[model samples]
Target: MSDQPANLREQALEEAALWFASLQDEQVSEQERQAWQKWLAESVWHREAWAKVEQIDREFHQLPTQRSFQALQSAGRSRRQFLYGLAGAAVALPFAWHQRDILQAAWTPGTLHQTAVGERRQLALADGSQLWLNTNTLITVDERAARRQLFLLHGELYLQSAPETQALRINTDYGSVDMMNTELNIRLGNNSAHLAVTTGEARVQLAQDTTPVTVAKKESLAFNQTRSVLTEGISANDEAWRKGYLVAENMRLEDFLKALGRYHSQGWLKCSDAVANLRLIGHYPIADTRKVLDTLAQSLPVKVRHITPWFTLIEDNRNISHS
Candidate 1:
């Protein structure tokens, strides 16, 4: 019985390893990529095994390119059978042992602070600043004798700078925000960063432009790699996420669900186009997503279906009936 469980684990690892190797090919088709993703999403065990295989392979790259290729070839009779063969274990073990230092350094403290999916965290900096991290956020704090800096690698953060003598700044790939005893909210999106000032003021300097634009209280700015645009009359509801609530005012259903999905750890919330434009106004708690979905079903002309733990679909009820 114990051997049966071991055999299952080995089978899963072998399959994951095959997928990992196949994906490395430059000639891999889109259909093959989709199938691989489906396999990865089907089970947690498969994901974990694939992650380990990827890590081992990455470590293999540190060796001489020609030697690494030879090693991989020798591990299996053919490239496709590389991970399943007996030599696979032999090839992977040495790289794993050699890369321990690299893996440990990657996760060193003070270099990175991250909030898990569906998790929030609050931190008090040494300079008395308050930092609140939203779901799936990663940030790094660098405090120097001359200046204090923060880099938002991804996700959102609300920062309240304490009254301090040092100059404080927050940086993203798009731009940087200079703060002086300021309270602000910044969310990093694809290719852009959204900045809203709650109190005091912030100066935003985009990557392409040298001149910093000043944003005052109740103001917001959206900047990409090339430019920054400032807007007045920032909504109070924008900061509602700090209090663990999502406040939407006649917001499109698709947009609302996308915002709500940030706080959810389970399946993605997907809405059909038939009801995507439906407007909703409400303050929903971010903590209880199941209840939020139930509320949506009650208030809107839509039916929520849980296809899987990782996929929830919202379809127009009227269309469903007609069909």
Candidate 2:
């Protein structure tokens, strides 16, 4: 409903983002919020921007906190010196370029930051830690005065803990991971969690047992409600996904499709039994599932049957008997 020109809308949106971020910060003062109202009353565009930013939050699931946005703005969104009228220009942001409209979630307390299917997001927390959220992930972060805590509710994440707080703790339903200047990957399944520590060490405590378990560098552990298995070999594939690729190292074809299905934009993706055990070896980009499916058909004796955007079935190309 905002008829403001694109440029004004963009500027309004930027300021709205700053206000949204500012309001959610526990450090925000009443005076600053009152100042936001003054700026809001200055123009219709400002109100529209605020509304738009709120709408974005409704869709995206979480807004970037100060720590989250500060680093992200430094990464992909080009920055320029911008002074805020809110807080009487007390805040400064390196906001000079147009940012993607979708990252507008305002980080509020206890909110879950999520990524849609087929989408990956990298977040830079205020504590200097970095987090890359895999597709269809849900996680919550709590950075209070004394320490920082992360909750991995579902899906996968690759995190490099900030040196400032090696004591940061991450909680999943299965247990908690206490980082010691760590770089790690975690994925939560229906009844289990898989953790891989690439560098540094972590102390894990499962829900069923208060006993702490140590996972050293290069070690991978998968645990459920009752048991845990410490193994190896995740060093390669897990790291590859952080770089936007799904690497299949002689992985089974059905398993490969299972991994790819996590990033499928819609519907179900499956392979027929005939090609279920076919071994696949390749590193395919995950940004486009359709492209990956097409590539899969080209590389092996498989036929990709894309009935619609929502239905995909891969069958044996060599079998000419069935439809």
Candidate 3:
């Protein structure tokens, strides 16, 4: 919205990136460091771009080096190359930080159990209950004399409680769900939490509501800190991700891609406006997202464009067909 041209802004970022790269070298001269400082002080845009680059570097430094290097390696890139690309392309630092935070939390030793991206794990509790963790999930189990509690830091998990005198509770930022002898799935979304009761019953106590809402068997509820609970029917295939497949029934292309992206470690999936609203119905394997995209392109009026190993775009095939 400002008067700055896109190309100019990109150029400024690139210039700032060069200075950063230069400073990283052990043989950098005093004159070069002075030049970089002078350039950084010359213009506001240059300073702003350098600040963002520094922020990205700071976040990366906070993460475990091996994990960060592995993520870059999977994308066929190095850390320096990725940082330069981020600067030139103006990648969102906050989003990168968020992903790092998820990975960091998953690696935290405090949690009794955790799962990495595209990895599902099963555990047998001491009380004969079972727990299944979905991709990028972090949960800590607390078994006290009175109750069994789980704190879901991120992602989704399916729980089957054993028959016990004490109740089971799952806690998140938005609220908590209390259950006993119940089979349920809990997913932590960006702004809300989803609780689906596959068997038995559970009660959700949202932070905003004074009274708790009871979720019956075969019912799904989504609630946030500010909104009332929205309930819907749960199909048998709702928990199919536990079996390594995502069952989509007339789901929007954008929504489907977002769900699929969670299992993919390479990069993000983006749908162009021309195809974002298109509906899809199918069971896609969570194991191989590239294959799923290829299959989707064959079935739907869309085309998959791989911009990079880390970025894919889905566009309407009608335009390509006409062209």
Candidate 4:
């Protein structure tokens, strides 16, 4: 009986190994893709075993290309070398590695993600990373094992990366940054790109044309993705969304409304162009943005009107209050 179980285990591992090899070829026939999909869905054990192999393969790929080659080339090195490293130690570590490889090979380069209006999604990567995306956010994941990569096309997100054998990176319209055990928030504003780190640390290598800056815990920074203005440790104001709130410390009314609008459905919040330059300060509940609008109406000269359950417009062509 034990011998039968042992044979099954060996069979499973062999199947997994083959899948890993198949993933390397850039071109796979549709028939082969369908066949693999069938095998993955046929039995839970088959899927689970293949999943393990994939995780291992991803970690293998993530290794700095040189380091990975060295480890693979070294007779002394074992699979364990790639199993124990990551931002989060997945006891199912091999599973994480294998999944990474699987997803990378399957992804077509330059795939873009977009949210139409009141859409938000939480993405979980094969390597165990979690992305809390805000409405109207656009992003793409580039799954290279040696370095985990994400490209933010627009809007905001909260990222918690899984442990890996190598560094993890996030790319923006401006430049790219590597993250480790950290929480990062990104917002693309007019003429400026903003970043805030709530926990841990990040190394931001500015665009080659601009100056580089590193952001640490509880710090905020901004730069012109198109220009060379680099500022650091400005304030920790961007962490509000993580708690379902928007804490604006002396922010322009237009900017505040834009940030607040992400929490609600599309067309729900809008500010008149006249108040675009008006600066306001306070903590607004993102979870209940309507209440915040009410507060704004009472405190400021503006009036908030609900166009629908899904939309609201704020207008104050003339100033009724001064700050």
- Superposition TM-score, candidate 2 onto the true structure: 0.64
Candidate 4 lDDT tens digits, 24-110: 445545666777777778776676567776665566556555444333222111222322221123224434544443354346344
Q: Which is the winner by TM-score between candidate 3 and candidate 4?
A: 3
Q: What is residue 43's positional error in candidate 3, in angstroms? A: 21
Looking at model 1, the pairs that clash are 267-310
**Per-residue accuracy of model 3 over 90-187 as CA lDDT, tens digit each:** 24443464466567555543446777677889998778888999887778877853656787877789999888647878878788899988999988
lDDT of 1 by residue, 1-323 (tens): 22436556666666665465445555557778888888889887687678766665555556565555434322222222333432236356424533542354355323667775567899988878899998767787777535678888767899988885466888787988899989999988756889999999999989888888999999999999788889997775568877889998999998888788777665346676678899998899888888999999999999887643334667687644211
Where's the lowest-lDDT run of ten residues in candidate 2? 77-86
With a 3 Å backbone cut-off (N, CA, C), the pairs that clash in candidate 2 are 63-105, 63-106, 63-107, 67-126
Candidate 4, residue 174: the lDDT equals 76
| Per-residue lDDT value at 152 in model 2 | 78
TM-score of each: 0.66, 0.64, 0.68, 0.52
- Model 2, 1-323: lDDT tens digits are 33556566557766676566546545556778778989899998788778765664443234334433332322221111221212121112223211211233234334568876678899998878899998767777878636678877657899998785648888877888889689999988756899999998888888888678888899999987567888865557678887889988899987888778777664446566678899988788989878988888888898776543333567777752211
Q: Compute the lDDT of residue 209 as modeled in candidate 1.
A: 88
